[model samples]
Each structure stands twice: as structure tokens, then as C-alpha cells.
Target: ILPNVTIRMLLISTIESLSYDSQRYLGNFIKRNDLPIPFTYYLYNNETNLIDYKINFNLLAEVQCLSTEHLIIQVGSPTTIGLESLNTSGSQSLRSGCIDTLFGTAQIDQNKEKSCIIFDVHGTILSGINDTIILALQQYASLQFLYVTEADLETNFLPSMINNSISKPTIVCIFDDHYDKHLHDEHVNLVQQFTNRYRMKNWSHVQWFLIPTKNTWLTQSDNKQYDENERIQTLRSQLSYILQKINQTIIDPTLFRTIFQVQSLYWSLLHYSMNTLNYDSTCYFEVESELKQLFNDLSDTTDNLLITTPISYLQSKIKQNQMDLPRRNKTKFVIDEVQRYENLLKKIDQISDHTQFFIDLLTKRTYMEVLITEKYLEQWRSAYEPRLRSELINEKHKMIHLTSELKRIEMLEKQQKLNKSIDIQQQLQTAKENYEQSYKTLNEIDTKLMNIDMTIGLFFDEILSISDYNSY
Candidate 1:
């Protein structure tokens, strides 16, 4: 006989395994059916002696049942014989007995008052029995009986269970090898259905283990080498491994939460730095310092350091470029001012290109936050920058032509006394008209520049909205 603690641990492990498996199953079901529903799993172990366990279980069950549409409650090892008695009896007795075992007589009316489906599977069916049993315990409660060899469990039975379920139903499959290949294949196929439904890349959520029944019932001489405590520890370790396997299948929700915040902060910093580039020559150093601090903060909270490496490198490059900028304040000549303006424009282009590069890098990752950021970045890069650059180039060319015409007119005016020609007068008139056109063009460019700034501000606002919406 097993000690109470070992038995409790075993029961807990089994319930946890089933809970995770059901979660995987429901997750798949929702995706496959294209249903707008969230899934949750709750495990209740009535056989455990801990009063706290019972209290917490009841509290959670009540909360989950009311809160979620897709809720699964799995009760573990409720009676001495466990779920073994459900398979041997017909519908009426199965209902009465399993109901009492699962929820004590005191709690039966309360459990029956709630709307949920109860499902049971037979362990002995792993020897290859073909059976389908459905028991309606009450108007609100029902018990489903399934055997390992039944074809419908995968096809008709499970689909029906999910369809008829007011809330998500907990499915329990109990198996013992019996070394039968066909029976094993059926079980494998059943599990594969869930795996395929969930679109899992691996068997992380599926719990399959071989329990050493013979070792548990060993004679004193056979078990002389190992003490009771050692055996219990061994059993506990095996159960722990099974639970760990299931835990590894699902991505931690906390990681997504952290990534959401990090991605938002990253985009905000990029936007702020880009905007500051328009006015501040020393903004690169300041932005780089801020980014380094941000990276350090994120690195402390998450294991995804590699994802931030590109951004870090970009910041370092910006800092280096800032250090290399010419220190002279005012240009001595017009040509020097022109050169300075060109250098500033080139620096702005580099900043924009690098910012785009960082956003592109984030888009390659699979997180929703990254994808959303990428969408906004793509919109800005594709629509905003090219048009702005084209307009700037056009305006610069017009300014250059106007400057050349003004110089020509000055030369012509100096020569007008010497030449006294009608053609010179016409040329001067044309130069004045061209200068007036240049002023108009300059005004248009200024207006466009203001619009471009407003557009950029709007883009930043949209990004901020995305961050706010997804923060939770």
C-alpha cells in the first residue's frame, strides 16, 4: 500500500497533467473552430487531506466557472478506488457513485446546482475494449464514459463534448500499456489529434508516462535495497519530471508582458530621438545614454538580451558619430554654411536609416508587440520619408537655381550702363519674376515642412496609443 503523502502527490501530479493537457486541447479547439472564447483549466483534488487544498480548490472553481466561458474542472482521485468504479457500472449507478465520490454528499447539491460537464475514462480499456457510455446525472450535470479502443473518442465523442459543453469540459484519459500495439496506436492517434489541433511543434503539453506498477507492489526481498522514503522520493521525482514537461510546452505569459513593455519603450525612445535630431546637434549622445540605461533595465528583467544587441550597437554608433561632428559654431562663409547644412542633412538621413533598421530587426521576432511596431514603422518608412525627402530635394534645387539667377542679374545690372541694351532690360525683368517664383516656392516648402512635422507627431501618437492599448 502507498503512503498517504505519496498517494496525494501522485493524485496532484495526475490532476496537473490532465489540467495542462486539457488546456492544450481547448486552446486548439478554440483556434480550429475560430471561436471567440478564452480557455481556463481548474484542478480539484478531493482525496487530499489538506484543508487548505479543499478550500482553495472550491474558491477557484467558483471563480473560474463564473468568469470564463471555456472552463475545465478536473477532480483527481476522489475516492479509494478512484475512477475505477465508473467503468464497471451502467449509467444510473455510474452517475450516483461518481457524483458522490467527486463531490461529497454535503456538496453534491451545490455541485449539481452549477452547470458543467463531467467526463470519465477507463484505465482498463487500454487492454482494448470498445465502449461508449453517456450518463446524464442531472439536467445540469452529465458523465461521459469512453474506452481507449473507441474510434468516436477522437472523432465524434470529443467534438460533441466541446460542442455541448456550456463551459469547457475536462477530458480524462487513463491508460496502462498492456503492450498492445493497436490499443497504443489508438491512444497515440487520440493524443496526436490534440497535438495537431493545437498546432504544437513538440509534445511539450502532452503528458505520457509509464508508471512502474510492479515496483510499487514489490515484495520485501525485492525492495530490500531501497527504503520506503527512497521509493517515495523516486516516485515524486518522476511525477515532478512529468509536471515540468507540461510546464515547458506553454510560453510564459510574463515574458509576453515584459516584451510588450520593452517594445513600446523601444519605439518611444526611437521616435523621441528621431524628433530631437531635427533641432539638437547633441541629441545623439543624450539618446544613446538613455538607450543604454533602458537596455540595462530590460536586461535585468528578461532573458532576451540578444534581441536588444542590435539597438545597443546602433546607439553606440550614434554616440560615436555625435563625437565626430565638427565643433565650429558659425560658418565664416556662405559655402561653409551650405556644407554644414548638407552634413546635418546626411546625419539626419543616417539616423532615420538606422532607426528603420532597428524596427526591421524587431519585426523579425514573433511577438505581437514587435509585429505591431513593425507595421507602424513600415507605414512611416514607406509613405512619410520618401515623400519628405523628394520635396526637400526639389526645394533645394529650386533654391540653387534662384541663387544662380540672382548672381547673373547682379552681373547684368553692373554691365547695363556699359551695354544699354533692350535684351538686358528683358533679362532683368525675367530675373525679378524668377526671384518672386523662388519666394513662393520657399513658402510652399516651409508649409510642407510644417505638415511633415505634424505627420511625424501623429505617427508618434499612434505608436503611443498602441503601447497603451497592449500594455495589459
Candidate 2:
């Protein structure tokens, strides 16, 4: 139902394009489509002495339907009109460009651009009343404006929200019969039951409201016009309030990006601890402490960096590297820590500069520890281990020489036994004493060889456990 003038213009343009023979069918075609036939009413004139013909024509019209008027106001004319019907949010100026609207059930997973979504739970997308609601919502650039079938609402939308898959702000408008003028008792129960279900989940950021269906608003009798206008105005106010709330509550993209950056660094730190450092149970305890503080901060969802300075638990773990944890237990601990962080990361949707700073500090500390380990290992390989090996080799040569000398002296003493030679006996005793001393020296060297590998590790503890490193 177009405006009366627009309909006349269309009729005139259509008639001009047709031949005279074809024009005969136009009136019947207009009646078939239920369009009002254009007609004229002439004024009558009367004269006493002379006949004076005064002519006038009147066109019949009815009150233009609100739905048609609103439709024309939106798409029919270039100039906007009739905006005084509903008061909208003040942020209308903020929604100037193209809106990122994701329609249908296919885009349920990709709604990061959506700040407000209108779920058509009752299938009102094709209705004129819904078109008006959609026009009202188009003032916001951040709105997703989805049409979720009732079946999809249960299977997709609700489940996705509950499973923590959607990351965008959850400002939703649910169109249901619960808010209808002739609302049924069962409708009230359904609304209450679903509201309780969502409340039980305790999603702090979620905000949703139920409104009357399209037919309830537009299909009322003429007697209910006042009530219909009141509901429509109320609907406008609700939409305005929800969108305003969304504007106030939506997280900044920079914050989310920063948060993800810290998350990546945190994972890198964990990877280093597990794979590169092969951290013992004590080390993992320190990691868990850091995780505890991180988890608490993330749970709040509004704060910046929440972990305190110095990380005393990690410092303590560095001092006690020789706690002697079993390999199997160590592996299990790492896996558990990984799983914990995985869950924690899933909950992270925003971050701040403070969080980035905190994670950077943690990463730097771990890097320094790695550097210290490498330095100690390098020293052992370059100097200490080689020196120990050289000493062992020298002791082995001395043992062989002394054994040969003792055997030679014993042979000479046996040869001179018949004459009872004192010189040979003295030589045999000196050679045997030298052999015994060499054997004792070689045994001491062998003992040192067995324990030499652990010296550098102890050195690391001594260096890293000092109070100076604690503050770092």
C-alpha cells in the first residue's frame, strides 16, 4: 500500500506507456489487485439569468495505514519523516557507516562485529511490523540483527552461548508472545522458565529482553490503536536502553588484542618451562602459583594486570632445583599445567597494557634463567670437564710406570737372594712404596671422575639462588 500520490503517479506513468486498446483492461486489473480506482467528483452550479458553469473535482482518500506510511518513510521517499514516534539512543550518531549485519543461522559462530542481535524466535522477518523494528535497529552500526528460527534457538544459539563459544557482547532482543497484549499464562511460564535457565548459568555480560510479536503489534483492531501505539513506543525505549547499555559495556578491541598477546607469551613461557628447561616439580609449583594469580585476575574480567611483583614462589623454585622429582610425575604435572592454562585462555576476551607489562616481565625473568643455565653448561664443557679428564689420563700413565719399576726390582731381588745383596733389597722396597702411592692417587682420581659431572649443576644453584637474583 503506497502513498495515494505515489500510487497515482505510478498509474499515470503506466497508462502513458500503454495503447488505447490496452488501457481498457487497466481498471479491471487495478480492481483485481484491490487498488482503489481513481475517480472524480464535480461541483454543481446554478444560475438565474445565464448559465454559469463552475467545475470542481474531489478525490477520495482514507487514513494511510501506519505500516505503509512507515515503509514509505524508510524506503519510499528521499526525505525522512515521522521520527518523533519513538525516542532512540543518543549513540545514533555513532552508527554512521555500514552495519555488520549477520543474518540467518549460518553465521551464529561469527558475531564478533555484533553488539546487538535481534533473534526472530517467532519467525517475523517477513512481516511489515518486523520491517519497522529492523529499520529502528539499523541506526546502530554494531548490530548483527539475526533471524534465528525457534528450532535453531534451542539447537544453535542457546547452546553456543552456554558453551562459551561466542566472544562478542551479548545484547539480545527476543521477539516472543510473552509480551503480547493478550499474553497467555503458558507464555508467561515459558518466559520465566527460560529466564531462570539463563540466570542459572550466571553470565554476567549477557543482557536480553522479550518483546511482543509482530502480529500482536500490527494486527490489532481499530479500537486497540491507543494500546498499540503505547506498546510500540515502549518497544522503542527498550531498544534504546539495550543499545545504550551495550555501548557502555562493550570492551575495547585494543584491550582484547593486548590480552591475546599476553596469552601467547604465557604459552611460550609454559613451553620453555616444560620442553626446554625440563622443570622439576618445584619449578612447576612456582608456575602454578603464577597461574593461580593469573586465573584470579582473569576471573574478574575487568581489571588489568593483577599479579604482584618479584614472583617469590618462582624464586623459591629456582633455589631448590634438586628436589628429586620422578620423571613420570614431572610429565604429568606439565600436562596438567598446560590444560589449566588452556581453559584459562578460553575465558580471556580482553587485555590491558598492565597485563602486557606483567607478562613481559615474567618472560624476561625466564629468559635470564635459561641464559644462566646455558652459561654454566658452556663453562663445564670448555674448561672444567676437560681438566678433569686430563688429570685422569696423567694418573693412569704414572700407575703403569710404577707397576713396571716394581716388577723389575722384584726380579732383581730374587736373582740376588743367593748372595744376600742389601742394595737390591733396598731398591725393591723403594719401588714397592712408589707403586702403592701411585695406586692410591689413581683411586682418588677415579672417585673424582665419577662425581665431576654434577659440579656445574651445583654451581648453577649457587648462582641463581642468591638474594640478588630473587628481586629480578
Predicted structure with the largest lDDT when compared to the true one: 2
Candidate 1 residue-wise lDDT, 141-245, digit = tens: 222222222233244433443333222212234333222222346555444544455353232323433322232335454555565566566546654554443
lDDT of the candidates, in the order given: 0.35, 0.39
**lDDT for each residue of candidate 2 in 31-108, tens digit (9 for 90 to 100):** 456554332111223445542221100111111100011010111110111111121222322211111111221121
* Per-model TM against the reference: 0.20, 0.24
Candidate 1, run of 10 with poorest lDDT: 130-139
Q: After superposition, how far is residue 3 of candidate 2 from its true place, in Å?
A: 20
**Worst ten in a row by lDDT for model 2:** 64-73
Off by over 4 Å in 2: 1-156, 161-167, 182-191, 253-472
